[model samples]
Target: MMPMVLDWFIGNETCETIKTKSSDDVCQGDSTCYNVDNGSGYRCKCLDGYQGDPYLPNGCQDIDECKDPNLNKCEKICENTKGNYTCLCPKGYHGDGRTDGTGCVANQSGGSLIIELTVGLGIGITVLIAGSTWSYWAFKKWKLIKLKHKFFRQNGGLMLQQELSRRDSSTETAKIFSSEELETATNNYDESRIIGRGGYGTVYKGTLSDGRTVAIKKSQVVDESQIDQFINEVVVLSQINHRNVVKLLGCCLETEVPLLVYEFITNGTLFEHIHNKNKASSLTFETRLRIAAETAGVLSYLHSSASIPIIHRDVKSTNILLDDSYTAKVSDFGASRLVPLDQAGISTVVQGTLGYLDPEYLQTSQLTEKSDVYSFGVVLLELLTGQKALCFERLEEDRNLAMYFISALKEDRLVQILEKCVVDGAKIEMVEEIGSLARRCLRVKGEERPTMKEVAMELEGLRMMLEHHPWVNNDESRLEETEYLLGEASLKIGSNGGMNNVTYDSITDHIILQVGHGR
Candidate 1:
């Protein structure tokens, strides 16, 4: 259908008839009147560089077309006139400078130099130029090689080599990538390739030559003296092989800051699904529980199962990535630290996100596994309430979700604060159990919080109970059954790991409960 056009005119008669019969017209400065094809007799249009009704007094005002990119097709520099525009190329270039034309091309200064040399000198000039060019490139290549060596030594290349040499397993390794490889993979670090950004560094989405997609992180500049620390950290992180953890495939040390490459996660992040309006609608409570369990399990492995214990100093919903199948993949180890086997905790500068930081750790500067538990607790609250870790929009006391969540729980407002989707899908007791666990995790004292292993087991138990026995009613017998099944899961989770192979007899080996109405 044709769009509605609002045409203006002084009279129903044609422009020729109006002009011949009258001495003046409705058209004003720098405006002209034209016969309207519609029922209106005529319309006034500004000549150029103007907008608004041209029939009114002082309506046809000039506009700078150069101020807007779409208004001009200049390939180089654009200059606006009273009613038009002109394009001009910069120095050392020649062309019409209009995109519709030849645009701009570099002046052939090299040819001019060659011509001058040929006329003054002999044919030997050509050979001299060729030799000079070759030597120049050769010298530049040598300099680049020397610089690469300097960067390698400064970035702890030798230390990494020694650490790798100590490892006997060929399958367990982190590749040392060349700068060229990563640069090409991320198209020379183009802005469009960036997938995520944080205070630590920027992560780029890249495709390798082998058709493998990867997430490449280029870190900020580091102190050269602390090279051994980063190199050792890389070694420890590379040894961590967990399905729910984003694998560290390789790193590049030739640049000012190291570049780390990891397996690309298909789904964006747990935070996105939990908080994004469109995604949050479809994010079920069951999926949130599974993601929470998976994240907890990874943290447990990092703390206990790895060769060296690792404390994820930073943990939040954003760090919990999701795979194509919506499986959780815990990531962003920039703030992670390896805990020595002999020590229960380490003394370090306090570091963590605001709403997720353990209060004890923040005050004492003691890093521990419970710090991760605290952050994970904040993530749980986010999944539960679909709120950010910190929000200024809320009242001052209610700003921090962690404190506010516990406050809500204390006041028995759990149902009121929970995300509608979560409250809609889950039973009250199930939600209460998870909320209690999160409260324990978010205790002010790090020592008061349960170990990551215990937290993982609790979440796993809940998951298993849900899988084994679907809820029927909120009666006393059903609640007892739920409790018994959860207890059963706690005992057998180590062996079954929430797999489908759990048999009824095996799960109920010791616990005896009466069935039906019998005593």
Candidate 2:
């Protein structure tokens, strides 16, 4: 078919055309133009690395190739002029950066030697730094391990191991724990794990890898002079097996001050039960009597049953702990003394709670089994009256509960000073008997106080009597009978003076009125 024709009218003429020329028909030499196809126009374009319109004179000029990374193949440096680009080697390089020549090469003499020396020095410095860091870390790790070993040896680890080896294999042995094991157990000795603190140390609660909960007692101060004594105590405690005494399961000696681990008791201390208002109400007369009996039994065993006679120098309610079942577990032997078979008493520093301290032992600086008996007597007073052994809250004359108890008994006012729970729960006769027994124990002379075994037997008998004869009465005649049974010898006043003004009749009247108001 013939191409379509277009007609145009100029000022004075008319024309008809069947064809038209486009720029694409005249494009040349590294320049190009594309036809519009619609017949309106065409466009011109230069090849890569060149810029300008291809239809104009000198329009397709050479581009400065150095400005673009893709167009330049220089190894070191590139330069550009008005219409061309050049690749040149940088200083210290021998060859031209061109396609026909070596791109870049090191100088033959001094420059190449300098480059080699610089690279070698850099590698040496890197290796030296790496070796130094590795050596430093290795030395630190070795020093730490050596320090731990030294501590283990210094804290009597070898002695403890030998002692354990000498014991019977059938019996449970006290474990020697590593510092890491205990640290992991107690979360690195976290403050939250602290269960108790005292003059000796802090006690932390820990759960071992074996899932057993334990109480770890860490000493606050270390006396190098007492290392022998400390190890001896460990040996003695490990050999002891009693239900009333807290069990020493293991020890960690790598610490600055040695740590002792015991089976954890869920319930708090006996002092807490006796002193805390909320917990006091729960300690009924029966529970208190039972606790007293158990504590006495433990002291008796320490005095007589153990292979060595151990005098518990600090025997107060706080040292006695209770489990979930309220069973007694005597702890804290930091001040205990081991007595020889022939020695009657150990003369040493007077160390004990002020209120429960034996006046004779305090004056003479002599510790004995009777000193423990005296302390136990004060604990009995605590149970009967729910009063602290030494409470400044009371009137000046009645600050010391032991002295106050003796004064009350001497004036026949025991019923007035006794705990309300004890009054309501126990027979007046049993209370009187316990009071007389306690009076005998608080004698100023250690020799005058009954033996721990004797005290334990008396408490046990009272417990058995209360359990078997629960229906016993609290009649006035029985009260008189109990008072007479005490005898003048058991009630004899010691150097510790008594209160004179308080009478039983007046205190009884006051208590009767108080009881009446309560009802």
Candidate 3:
């Protein structure tokens, strides 16, 4: 009030004197208030190391002089304080301005006590934080690698190796693939590379760095009950050295679910080609017969030639793969059983594909090599008729093709159900021979079926006979006109309508040179 009265005598018409006095009263810390002298009221100024007018609210700020490149004393490190800056030592270097002494004065050995204390404290804190973080990350990485190794050993890696060694080392073509290699090949087991899925595992197509294509089958989670079965499957399949069998290249046990690597089959499964309309019509009788013969040869090889005879408990058309040349390559030994040669048979629970499964084996809980023979026979029926083993779309009595086929044979009505593709006027004898052979194979008693060796021999004979005389068994003359257009040589049919061999290789040279279309 006294200041205001004094300013009123000095012409305080706009109250500028009172306002300046009020602003000056609030100024603090290296600041002062002054009137603009032009009657614009009052403002405040801060001293060095501060910013803004102190008279206004939140106007003052500490100066960031360290941001200036010229203020940096260290090579790469710089720090700012209230009115001063720091000459901090750079990373991997020590001493406080004693070595270079560029901007800061040198501190002597013992006389540098204060400078050393501050520098040491800062360096020590930084190093401790960095080292703790690095250690934590390194520990985590090491633990992950260790866990993978533990699982590799636990999942019967050593046991599988021992099983593989028991066989003829020279004949086995498969190589042991490492977990890291497979992971890299499949892009760390990426979901996009998956080609097929099954109840037990997912199958992925992988290409190695060396350009080798492979199928990697990764098993689903293994429960306690399935562990032994899984291990047993690995053991049995690893030792099988037959050419017809699907080659088990190796396995990766590092993952939570084990992965099995197999040789890649390019043309896909026989089942796909048979059921698919386009593929079914493309197959010729010769291709189908060859597929049957090769498949039977594989079954026979497993049942008789293996060290411990194997019964492929589940033999279905889907499990049979075809090569680029349409050559049949039997695969999928996951459900195979190793039977001791000395034993007549083994007693096991029923397990197999439903339609192809042997009724005798399923009912008795007694499995034998003939169980696979029955399944093979059912697959043979599929090849003959180009129909599914079980199709509910048909009448109830004709739904199960195997049952329908057997009934047809009993009623002498096989010609009614034969696929148009197979109706190449096959001689009645040859047709009866094949039908009778299939019926014998599907006999209710396992002992009644022919051995795989017999089946293979018979099919091979049929192939040889047909190749020598192409026209003998063909029922359809439309196929004859097609063959004539293709310039295939004609065979002579006797009065009995049976085929006699004639030379056709000269004309067939071109056709044989062509790529095989059926798989």
Candidate 4:
């Protein structure tokens, strides 16, 4: 057994085989502990950072921390005794704590000299503190300048300037704004000046030196590699000029991200009126249809009439701004793609907001004009239902409004799915016509969707019908006139279920029910 234990210790026998050896255990003295085999015995020293052999009686005593100057962080004077130390301020200062200093030396004399010295030292300390704070602020300001310069370069400020220079005569000049000018205009970029914020960046409401109210869009930071894309966007935006599309007034490139200036639309986004809790009740069906038509017209212009066909990758309600009178101003071209006339489509990474993204473009990454059509479909649905493009309250697979709408159509339960706002007896024929238009727009295949021009025409037709046949409060004669103006007086809305859905025909009913319901 001793020979086998020696063999095991010398590695001649395996550890597993030597486990049952009763004489294999070994022990060391009080200060040290050991595990022994014949020749492979080793010992461990007590931990330095800690103390004591873990197995010994009372273990080991802690090292005198005060004895080691390196472990002490005493600011001024450290006097070591045994296991602890005393801290003292230097001769000029007087304090007991390690990091503290009692004012300067306490005055000993009642003389004017002592008073003068105290005043001078107090003033000196105040000045020093103020200077240090100023220096820190100056350092931060300098760092911000350098960081903004780096971002400007990263966002292709140089390329944009070059592009502007090349087309200075033919194109409307693109302004290169300074940070100081923008900061002054926006009152140091105060939150009160913030008009909008979204995936692109925050927008500030600014009154320029020239007294023009403008919407300033600060682009989000981009990686250095995306500088080319940034320059491309600037170039494309500079060329855009449509009455309905938000006008690009200028830009500021001195900031880390480029800041775009646009003509301010005071009424805010179309989404606000259609869905915002404070404003939705004021939006009539006629206004919704008119806004839809105007939006479609702007989109059609972008798709076909722009110098280069621009596919507005994002075409949700939020992107559509409204002037004081609610005239639609299509905006936010951050995700817009300029499709070249020579190319049929662009194969690029999918980019667009989730609810508004084209299913075909999302799946295949082949972006075309029809991708805009799909997004416009969502917008149409929003206008029709006064609900969001995506809602969790809906069924799992039908969570998306487009899918839910299509499902509603398939089941022929259109009136049930539409908001109560639109359900107050819209003519079955009129509702069917609008629903069919929405269905065509929401076609699974892009090619099957109508051209933006056709969509605009259809929406215009809908608008004209609503304008002539305004939903009334009381007079049956006026209702008859509305029917006559619609060009077809035969269409009826309600089923024969005694639940006759009809427009309010009395002034009292109009006041009670509020805004006119059917368009």
Q: Per-residue CA lDDT of candidate 1, range 15-46, in tens?
A: 88888988997588889888877676887899
Tens-digit lDDT string for candidate 4 (342-433):
98689877888878888998899999888888888898888778778888987888889998888888888888777555655354565566
Better of 1 and 3 by TM-score: 1
lDDT of 4: 0.71
Each model's lDDT comes to 0.81, 0.79, 0.71, 0.71
Q: Give the winner by lDDT: 1 or 3.
A: 1
Cα-based lDDT at residue 212, candidate 2: 96
The stretch of ten residues in a row with the least summed lDDT in candidate 1 is: 499-508
| Residue-level lDDT tens digits of model 3 in 394-422 | 88998877899988887888887887777
Candidate with best lDDT? 1
Predict model 3's lDDT versus the native: 0.71
Model 3 superposed RMSD (Cα): 17.9
Sort by TM-score, top down from the best: 2, 1, 4, 3
Segments in model 3 whose C-alpha atoms lie over 4 Å from true places: 1-143, 162-174, 221-242, 471-519
* TM-score preference between candidates 1 and 2, better one: 2
Kindly provide the TM-score of model 1 when superposed on the true structure, using C-alpha atoms. 0.68
Top candidate on TM-score is 2
TM value for model 4: 0.64
What is the Å distance of residue 183 in model 3 from its true position?
Answer: 1.8
